[model samples]
Target chain A: MKISARNQLPGTVRATTMGAVMAEVTVDVDAGAIVAAITRGSAESLELKVGDKVTVLIKATEVMIAK
Target chain B: MKISARNQLPGTVRATTMGAVMAEVTVDVDAGAIVAAITRGSAESLELKVGDKVTVLIKATEVMIAK
Candidate 1:
């Protein structure tokens, strides 16, 4: 699917940690591991599991730069 | 400064677009151009301009993933 976010890193799921309302999914990418915090409902809907392939998305607005 | 955010990409400033409250700063990284929307005050404080070296940061909680 097409997304507006500029950063898209393809990776394999490494771990999943679910909280009451949020879930953190760790993905192993070429650079390293990236952790994403998403809604538990979305996680459940996606049925995310270890070894599954996914793409991490980050919006340009949510990005920050340090000099 | 040390930050907990996992994704940190080093790049050079490419452009800057300022609005009333927020400013968009584009950085040219190894991957490509990454845009960041920051408060105009912050942008001014940093004195961001073209050709400046910087590091793009994204928090884990602000990230999402798709299958």
Candidate 2:
């Protein structure tokens, strides 16, 4: 689905850390490594694995700029 | 406050659009323009103005990776 979030980075899954309710996935992008915390359900649904190609998406509201 | 969101990008406030309840902020980072949707309260609190320097913050949970 099309999203409004402006930041989309194509990267490779560097690592995955699963928790009871949440999961952390680290992606290696050209800029740097981006870490994402997604629900365990979403993580499992995606069947994310290390070295998988993916694109990281972030919503505008979820972004904060500190001056 | 310290945050767990790993992506921190230093940029300049390119523009800001405020509404009754929400505001959209555009920051020009090294990579590109990063847009942020924040509460009007937060936008007012920050007093964000054009050309202001800021660091964009994103939480890991707010990030999503699509295969």
User: Would you estimate the TM-scores of all the predictions?
Assistant: 0.78, 0.81
Candidate 1 ranges with C-alpha deviation above 4 Å: none
Instruction: Give candidates' CA RMSD values in order.
Output: 2.4, 2.2
| Candidate 1 residue B16 C-alpha distance from true site, Å | 2.2
Q: Who wins the lDDT comparison?
A: 1
Tens-digit lDDT track for model 1 on A1-67? 5888877878899999999999999998765677898999999999999999998888988999898
lDDT of 1 by residue, B1-67 (tens): 5899877878899999999999999988765677898999999999999999999898988889899
Single-chain TM-score of chain A, each candidate = 0.91, 0.89
lDDT of 2 by residue, B1-67 (tens): 8776688878899999999999999998766678998898988998999999998888787899899
TM-score, second chain, candidate 1: 0.91
Lowest summed lDDT across 10 adjacent residues in model 2 chain B is found at B2-11
Q: What pairs collide in candidate 1? A: none
Fraction of true contacts retained by every candidate, in order, equals: 0.82, 0.86
For all candidates, the clash counts are 0, 2
